[model samples]
Target: MIAALGLAELKLLLRNRTAATLAVLMPLAAGLYFALGVGGEDDSWTMVVTLQLLFSFGFTVYVTVTTALTARRQDLYLKRLRTGAASDVVVLTGILLPVVVLGLAQALVLLGVSMAAGAPLPTRPDLLVLALIGGAAISCAAGVCTSGLTGTAELAQITTAPFFFAMIIGGLMGMSGGEDAWVFLIPGGGLGTLTGAAWGGPTDHVLEALASVVAWTAVATALSTRFFRWDPRT
Candidate 1:
């Protein structure tokens, strides 16, 4: 039952214009955007943008947009599935796993290509792993939470704008903070620290960074668990 639902979800996503574009084009575009945004710096700034890409996509695009899109269009199908052989947990996992798996796979592929093309390997592998897991989980939960608020598929684009802007600002500030007072308030600062640690952060810094992602995850997940709607708004 889980396998069947996963297959169906995959097919449905493949047929959507937005999902197809996001899955195929968003990563490369993000790489280019980050590269350009940071101006090919030799310092830790560039690393900041790279990890920002991972967090930004996981939260801004994947969690928020895709979840809302699926809920708006397929809520009926999803609600019905919950009543069948598949458990609610299985049904949600099937719908959500494809993008999460694809994102992780793509991140690995990008890491390999970046290394081949001269990027250095991560120094704090544990920190990097935490960011990947914590950040992605939060984003996924946030998406489910937001989907409960959305009214239609088309509205998703407009609804997701705030997160997109937040991510862009976060990425930019993350790359340019020079002990600026306002930097710590920016979520991207924590993300930058994590990315920097991935290049070998001090133990203290890595712990702090891990804490930030975990805090974010907790907040998003708590909200999602409380408010997420399983049925269509109509």
Candidate 2:
């Protein structure tokens, strides 16, 4: 049942030109530009790759999920899905699975681009994977939380802006090579640290970074559970 719903959601996602652009083309374009077009003697590959992952999660996963959920609710699709045999968890996962998958795929592609542009290979593949998963999970949960407050799919652009910017800013702060403890409190900060460490940037505080990602994921999940709606807001 989840597979069927996921396939349906994927089809719907591909059919919507605007959503498809945002999910598929936009991130790829921006990431390729960042990896290939931008260059500086002082540029850290870790920072560039971290920003790429941030963009993939922020626009592809986060914005797309919020838009999809609010659009489905407005169309009564979410309400109808809940009436079926599938559990709420299954339904929600099915709807979000494609977006998450797309986000991860984009992350890998952008990482490859960075590597092709002469960035060193990740020394810690496991940590890189963990960062990717944590980033996607947090972004997905935050999307669900945002969807509850989004009256329309069109409004998701405005609603998702705050966290989207936070993600970028956090990445910048994490890559600043400083010891600012408060940086990890932001959305993408810990993920950036983990990504950097994966690429041999710094490993002294990996556990702290992991804990930050876990904490953010927990908070976002809790808020999503508390606020996510299956019906459109009136």
Candidate 3:
């Protein structure tokens, strides 16, 4: 049942040309832009990895999931799913699975492009993998919370902006070594730390980074549990 719903969601996602383009093209384009235009003569894998995370996990995942969830709620699709035999977890997971998969694929594509463009392979592959998993999970849960506040599909972009920008800016700052201690409280800060560690930048903050990611994930999950609405907003 979950598989069937996931397939249906995938089809729905593909049919939406705008969403499909953003999910596929945006990450690729951003990666190439940063890799070629930004990295310059210094083979900086940090820039590549940071940009990939920002574009893939930050923008693409958050916006796509929020928009999709908002559309489904507005169209009564989520409400209909609630009436089915699928449990809440299965229903929500099925709806979100495609976006999650796409985000991971985009991450891999970005990594490949970065490597081809002269960025070295991750120095700490484990840290990179951890960052990717944590970032994706955080983005998906954030999207659910964002969708709860969105009144319509058209409003999703605006509604998701604060969270998206927070991640982008905080991530950039964290990656650049702006250590205020509080930056790690933001969703993307831990990801930045982990990604930086992946490039052999620092390992002293790994535990803090992991804790930050886990903490944000917990907050986002709690928000979604409390506020996520299946039906359209009145």
Candidate 4:
């Protein structure tokens, strides 16, 4: 029953033009644009993971966060789910599973494309997996935490500004071949560390990045549990 609802939500998301386009297609588009824009440099495994992280974070975190909040507000989707056999945890988990699966699939696709294009496979596949899993989880949880502050779905874009900016700025840092001390605190920066570990030697800073992710996830979970609303704020 819960699985059905989760699959239903995935279908609904696919049907929505803005949500589907951004969530599914936007990353591919960005990857193409970057691939072309950079003229397919002999980028490192770090670059490969960074590109995948770009997709997962931008689509799953930025786009999906607003979409979830708006779906709740406009369609009363959250409210309806709560009235069903689904418990709150079940509903949240189910709704998120689609995004999680999509993120994993997209990352794998990107990884395959990168390798087929002559890029080396990640020297450490485990680290790549860490980046994908940790980044996706953090993005989804952040979305839920962000949803509580959202008033409407249309405005989901606006409320998503801070996190999106943080992720982007952090990505930019990775591209510059250097990292900042504070970026270690950004959600995406954890991904950067994971990517760096995959493509190059360990930074000895791995624990800091993982710790940052754990802290953010803990806080987001606490906030979501306290403030997530089934009904529209009105």
Candidate 5:
């Protein structure tokens, strides 16, 4: 049942040109642009790769999931799904699975492109894996929380802007070597630290970075559990 719903959601996402662009094209394009077009003697390729991942998390996964959820809820799709054999977790996961997969795929593509463009292979693959997994989970949960506040599909873009910008801006600051203790507190800061560590930065902050991502994921999950609405807003 979950697989069927996920397939249906994938088909719908592919059919929508705008959603397809957001889910795939935009992130890839932005990643390539930043990785290839933006360069400086002091700029690190790892930082470029980290920025690309941030774009994927923010503009791709976060935005696409929020828009998809709000659209489904507004159209009564989520409510209908709840009446089927699927449990709440299955229903929600089915709806979001495609976006999550696409986001991760894009992240891999960006990593490949970055490497092809001469970025060093991750020194700590474990940290990179953790960052990718944590980023995807956080983005998905944040999307659910944002969708609960979105009254319409059209409003999803606006409602998701704060999180999108927060991750992007915070990620940029971190990648640029911001060492402030509070940097890890930002939504995507931990991801930046982990990715930086993957690029061979200091390891002392790994625990702190992991903690930040876990904390954000917990908070976002709690918010979604508490307030996510299946019915359209009146």
Candidate 6:
């Protein structure tokens, strides 16, 4: 049943040109621009890869998830799913599976492009993988939380802007080295730290970055649990 729903969702996602473009083309274009145009020194590569990951998570995973949920709710599809036997978790996971898979695929492709463009292999692949997983989780959970506040699919663009900016800012802070401990509290801070560490930039703050990513994921999941709406807003 979950597989069927995921398949259906994938079809719908492909049919919607706007969502399709955002989920696929936009991130690819942004990532490729850096991968192809940026210099390959370690510091420069760290910044480039950080931006590429951020672009993929922010637009491909985060925005697409919010927009998909909002559209489904507005169309009464979410409500209809709730009437079925599937648990809410199953329903949401199914709806989101395709988006998450596509996001991971894009991330990998972006990394490959970076390497092919002269970027050296990551010095710490484990931390890189950790960063990718944590970042995706943050984006996905944040999307669920944001979808609750979105009145319609159209409103998702406006409603998601604040966190989107927060994630971008956090990523930048992480790449440049946060002057204080507080930056880790931001959404993409952990991602930046982990990505930088993966590229041999620094490891003094790995624990803090780990905590920040996990903490943000927990907070977003809690918010979604408490506030996510299954019905369309009148």
Q: Pick by TM-score: which candidate is best?
A: 6
Model 3 regions more than 4 Å off: none
Instruction: Provide the clashing-pair count of each candidate structure.
Output: 1, 0, 0, 1, 0, 0
lDDT of 6: 0.90
What are the candidates' C-alpha RMSDs? 3.3, 1.3, 1.3, 2.2, 1.4, 1.1
Error of 3 at 80 (Å): 1.2
Look at candidate 1 and give me any clashing residue pairs.
123-198
Model 6 misplacement above 4 A: 177-179
Q: For candidate 6, what is the TM-score?
A: 0.97
Name the regions of candidate 4 deviating beyond 4 angstroms. 43-45, 174-180
- Give per-residue lDDT, candidate 4, residue 183: 73
Of candidates 5 and 3, the better by lDDT: 5
Stretch of 10 with least lDDT, candidate 3: 171-180
Q: How many backbone overlaps does candidate 1 show?
A: 1
Q: Which 10-residue window of candidate 2 scores lowest in summed lDDT?
A: 37-46
Ordering by lDDT? 6, 2, 5, 3, 4, 1
Model 5: per-residue Cα lDDT over 76-179, one tens digit each: 99999999888999999898998888899999998888787777778899999998999999999999999999998778878988888888777766654447
Per-model lDDT: 0.59, 0.89, 0.85, 0.70, 0.86, 0.90
User: Per-residue alpha-carbon lDDT of model 6 for 1-234, expressed as tens digits?
Assistant: 899999999999999999999889999999998887885666698888998899899999899999999999999999999999999989999998888888888999999999998998999999999988998899999999999999989888899899988998899888655557889988899889889889887788998999999999999999999878999877
TM-score of each: 0.81, 0.96, 0.96, 0.89, 0.96, 0.97
Candidate 6 root-mean-square deviation in Å? 1.1
The number of the candidate with the highest lDDT is: 6
- The superposed Cα distance between candidate 6 and the true structure at residue 149, in angstroms, equals 0.1
What is candidate 4's CA lDDT for residue 116? Answer: 66
- Model 5: lDDT equals 0.86
Structure candidate 3, residue pairs in collision:
none
- Name the better of 4 and 6 by TM-score: 6
lDDT of 2: 0.89
